[model samples]
Target: MARGSLVPETAAHAATTVARATGHRAQVDVTSDGAALAALGRTPLLLRVTAFSMFVFPSSMVIKDIGAAGTVPMILSCLLFVFWLASWIWRLHDPVRVRHPGRMAGVFFVLGIIVSYTALYGGWTGDATVTGLAAADRWLILAFASLGLILVAAESVKTMADAMQLLRWLLAGAFFCGVVGLIQFTLRVNPMEWVQLAMPGFTYNGGDTPFQARGNLVRVAGSTFHSIEFGVVSAMLLPLSIWRALYDQRGQRWFHWLQTALLVFAVAATVSRSGTLASVVAIAVLLPFLPRIARQRTIAALPFVIIALFVAVPGFVGTITDALGADTSDPSIATRVNNYPRVARMIDAKPWFGVGPGNYTVQNAQEILDNQYLNTIVSMGIVGLICVFIYLVLPGVAALHSARHAAFPALRCLAGASAAGLAVAAVCSVTFDSLSFPTFALSYPLLVGLSGAIWIMVKNEGSSPAPATTTPQTTRMD
Candidate 1:
């Protein structure tokens, strides 16, 4: 009789009711198909492919002789893009209606890169290492691939279960990285060497080993291209691991907590100033939103963790402290400081749209600007820099908005975790050329897309009609 008054007793009746309310039988059928798909209990194809490409293989590995363009994740992203495009073209009805702000921002950011590249087309000088066209093409491929990931992930994740699964995959990947890093640190050996031997056609582009040294202490990169990248990635994922540890079911709690510990140890293994700072930033952003019990537990564990780190790694705490306190005399600090004047001149030449993406090579510029924000300015100009901020920061903002309004505690925790992860990425961008690295470049967009999906779920939950009072209620994951 009245809307939201009918209590369907059969599958047929439920479908009929849904069809009447939506005025589309096809929508009901699509819902049934989606349910059938979910019943299979397999990870969504895009999510699986992404996790495998990004985490299973070392980020430093590429197809033999293909260079940056041949990274496994990039190749998988391109394939996923084609699949998404074909699906979009073939779907005649019941298309996804969610319009996420993060998705819109990603589109604009990609467009800004294209605009900059078009403006500088053939006028750029060829460096001794890479041609201008080649550099631009490489960057464009990366930009497009990133956008493809954002779109696919946002569209594919249709429910809370999908979101949870995505997080699980990410956590699994981070755990793998952490374990590999700990091994590298303890054994003073690169495990990727064994991995390379096992795999054919994938070669390491990262150089002799995944180890770097500060004085006598050794730094480990795990599966990432550099120790700094490894540190930043661990810092970003730490919040998610902590969220799982605190909120996941009791049976899985121990495993998640172990994952959290591994990530902390991995970060310490890197001995990176930015990584340590990024970890602190993640914790600061995440702690305020966690429940009282979680917050208390985290605070209480801090002293023990610090004591363990001291005993386990010996000089780690002092190394991080000294690095943070280092003055301009420090080589890294001096390099960053000295680049400002040169970067200003470069920005002055073409303030609106600079030389072009990937054109600012160390070969031509004579120095590497570790700051991604500065790199964005030099390569894509002020407009591109603004776009970069929007693309990176908007998802976290959206995640926070969802967390504030979400009906379920689990959803809220997830939202907070996503926000914290993105915050780490945002803060770390200033400390390194984060996007230039394959691991972060791929991981960041996937997280953004997942956050957009979380936002959509919150919005959909808010818009749906309430259930009838007479019906027996069961808990919903969302």
Candidate 2:
């Protein structure tokens, strides 16, 4: 019996036969188990995160009625706290096998302290700190905590299998979100409001009621949150879909094409400038890595564009031009430019440490903090900035290294490209306001998984173990 990239059933049975002859029945079964888990374990973590309830439960039609508006996300955060608690308990039982590697968690703890302390200190200078404990602050921070919880659990406690399972679920939920977004796009409604009325604390925001925004057609964002959130949802799916298009399970080629087309339509229909642009840019960046046929298919798409334009005549082309040219005019770009000098002057008042968590948004007058970098600097101070640096830069570097050198060379192309693409988008986010969207909380974990998977796969080249097989493959999502 020979081992191939794919372990056919017959190959496994032959190995089992060999094991039986060797008087190793149990060992054969263990080998089979390891093989099965290995294939599954190779999927990327971002795909698994789709199954995360924080990503899923809110999208159903019954969100607000179920009392889930902020509640669902909140509970998801609590689940993180629970996960951490369990890790601590598990460590108590098996200290060696389950070392509390809070290596990642320690990074976050330092960040939280820096940001919180800076935010508080910024408040002390009283240049522009505004003080208040509001629901928005609580909800957003709760979401940030969820990211910390995921990394902490992933690094110190979770096995490769646990990571794989998470990606599976993340993909599953993302599929449903695509479905729900499709439904809303087709029907022009918010399903989360009506679908699961029994679930509490959920509120549906991903909808439009024939509403016009600034004279353009207002689109429904669906279960993801807002119009921008809809964009983020589409953005997350873009990479995974591209991954499947380039390298998928053997028989499902056409099926994956349909999935890709469906995502494109769903994203286009959302009519979100930022979301649409982000989705397009992200996928376009991935196009170079796609298979020749897939790449050609995208290139050949131009005729459809011309035909759609032909059908539209003047009405179609004009609307698209208008929509594309839609007013992103920063009414506030000028405001930020004017205000930041004063704000920076104020920040010079106390640049060492920031005000603390929630302080820039809370203590400062509402004007000082729309951008994440500016907000972070004003709130956390120099120490806070350094903490954020570790959180973002380290994982990004890890992912880049792995994506670049994956053992399954074809897998290397897109995983590396996607990691790089995400880094570009993340850096852009520092100056842009879109990071405030759900994608930030939703995506950081996926990035972590990619980084970890790439690193694991590269490190395990030629090794026939569970981590070697699963790390790269785990990236394949629902």
Candidate 3:
């Protein structure tokens, strides 16, 4: 009987020992897992570089010298090259889906440009002047480089959280530039002179006017080369700012509302008719995506809001009317309008490959076409036009698809905003030669990539299995 009692006691002790061992192992695992998770929370160095690079890209080239303007993207390309090399060496697996039909179309577009470049310019001899086809050819190279860098950024984003981080950086940069533009407009100051003073080699075209004063009003170009570019950036941000103001209730909602107001004011100060129209279109596109209550309220308040705007701002309607009237009588407008037939003739002559990439300036006798569609057909022919269109349009289509199908309200809203921005870009391209300006050219493509990233995340989240639930227990010895 005593022996039986000893055996039972020993058995209980053994069980206790086993339970203690299991608990220790679990504690170690939890600690190690937590450390690993913390490590994972840190962003990659390459991604950080890319994000930083993109943030400064739009505003960095105050000095128009090749060495100065090209430095940012050149550095970015080197960093991205390093990342690419490391990925190959380490066999790293990227979680983001980099392959899309739109991106592929962009590749073909680049190829089309290359073919045109070869056929027209006889390849880069590095001795060409910075006028006509040579200048366009150089920009073509820059475009390809910019596109690659953007792709790297798009691929680096693994989740919506990652995308938001990148987006915040981008928005912050754009806003900073906008503020600079506001200063230029309000103070009648040009920051370019200061920039030139700071950078000895930087040269400003004496003829270029960043602050074109019209009576009491001024056209502000911000940190960019032109007012149109500034307007484009403002228009692009309008939809995003509106979305954040309306829906993003995470924290500091007032800040977003403030951003929206500032963006609207900035667009107005630009006095760009296309920019204003683009903002209107951007706001309109979000109507269907808004909740029923919000949509109805907004619609009801819109007329009153319009009345208040016209009442509050002196010469508000006149600003728009001036732009419209100027379009009819402005020599620049007349020149651009007259170029359409010339462009049509150019296309008819070289219908297949056109005049070559970036050859329009030379062909058009240095007159700006003011239309990207006409410019593309004149420069790159029908094939190039198709490729460019696909590259620009497909991402918008994907965003629209995600907007329609996404279960998450945030993602859906973002997708809608992206679609709206793209629509605005397309329409505005008619008034501006979009590809000529880095602010307009680089931004639209990056936004497209962002939409793609969001769509992928939404798709992945939808397909992921639900987490299994397990009940907690007071003791492990059950």
Candidate 4:
């Protein structure tokens, strides 16, 4: 009797010890404290560099020495690079990690360089003058290089959360800008001028202006590349809103609905076919993913709500239908289709590195060609296309992986929607590259969103491997 009691008691003690050890291991945060700071510092710096480079260019145009204007981004980039290096060195002892599709993305990004370098060589024409270089095309070249670098670096560091926060900032900014545009329409004012507030020296000067400005609606592009580019930005936000809607509860996160609605209105005010089309496409793709409960609830309320809103605002239904119209008379549409085949033929001649970045505008004599894929090939070459491919593909891979591991439905929706949105946007890009315009900053956030999704996916997935051994380690000082 005594021996039996002792055995059970001893077994219980041993079990308790093992359980404690297991809990300790599970709770451990393998990440050294310095790792996170280094990552964070590196991540936001990318945003700063991009904004500085592009924004400075426009304001810099004000300065006579173009080189001085150009040097701003260069200096910012160098400074950011220095900071990143020092931070990495501080956290050098921490383990570096990345999972599957991210690896594939990194590989693809490098491959795209072939296309970039091809463009660099093929389009040079032994005339290396910046003045001789394609004016708008110069931005294209910078875009390619920047995107390639951003892709590889983002993947290498794996900063998904940082990306998400940036995207939120982007979408919120876009939404507010959309509101300003709506306000402009209400006040019967120039929307572009209002957008210039955030970007002190920014101004929009082009559009299909006629004798009456009404025929030539100058959509407020905010800090984006162009009004048309703003359309793409608006399109990108719709999916983000949907993702939020799917992930968040109405009571806890009503802002998702509000933001989404405002975004839709923004899209309406822009009157951009591409932007509207992108929004419709993004929402349409997201529709099937709605939960049965949400879908049912929406079905019950949506009809009445939509009808009420339409009745309250007579122009609402008309605006929607008008937007949906596939009236082929649009010259911009016709112009794009007509130019495409010619650009394709040009690609046939210089497929490896199509022409040179921004050369299409110059070669075509300062025209808004408005085709991203064609422009890419024409500017950088096959190599440029490859690099562009890398920039887009890696984030997608990260998003897909994130979707697989997302603990929250909203996060999953965000990840999936961003991925799908990018996919759709890429399709749009083949025909249109809005990132080139001075008013188009929406693409920046979209890119960041995709990159952010990847970072979240990686971080969550990484944590799964270690469990939650959350120890306080000194984060490397970035």
Report the number of the highest-lDDT candidate: 1
lDDT of each: 0.72, 0.48, 0.59, 0.47
Candidate 2 C-alpha lDDT tens digits along 1-478: 1112122245334333222221211111112223433444322232233335544555333334333224444444444434444444444223233222123533553555545554454456344433333422543454455454444333421223333344445555656666677666556665665544656444444422322232344455555655555655566566666564445444366666666565555555555455556665665656664545555766788569546533523243445456666453644345556567866864786686655545555334336454666765665566655665555556655555655555453445545554544554455445444334554554555555444544543454434333334322334422
Root-mean-square deviation of candidate 2: 10.1
Q: How high is each candidate's TM-score?
A: 0.85, 0.67, 0.77, 0.66
Span of ten consecutive residues with least summed lDDT in model 2: 21-30
lDDT of 4 by residue, 112-220 (tens): 5444544455544334445534353345334434433343334333333344444455555656556555555566564544333444332323332211221334354
250 Cα displacement, candidate 4 (Å): 13
TM-score comparison, 1 vs 4, better candidate = 1
- Cα displacement (angstroms), candidate 1, residue 104, comes to 1.4
Candidate 3 error regions (>4 Å): 1-82, 85-90, 94-97, 123-133, 195-208, 213-216, 246-251, 292-313, 325-327, 330-332, 362-366, 465-478
| Highest TM-score model number | 1
Sorting all predicted structures by lDDT, with the top scorer first, yields: 1, 3, 2, 4
Per-residue lDDT over 288-392 for candidate 3, one digit per residue giving the tens place of the 0 to 100 score: 765555567768977876676566445666876776678646766788877778777777777876666666654453477887878877777787788777666
Worst 10 residues of 4 by lDDT: 469-478
Query: Against the true structure, candidate 2 has what lDDT?
Result: 0.48
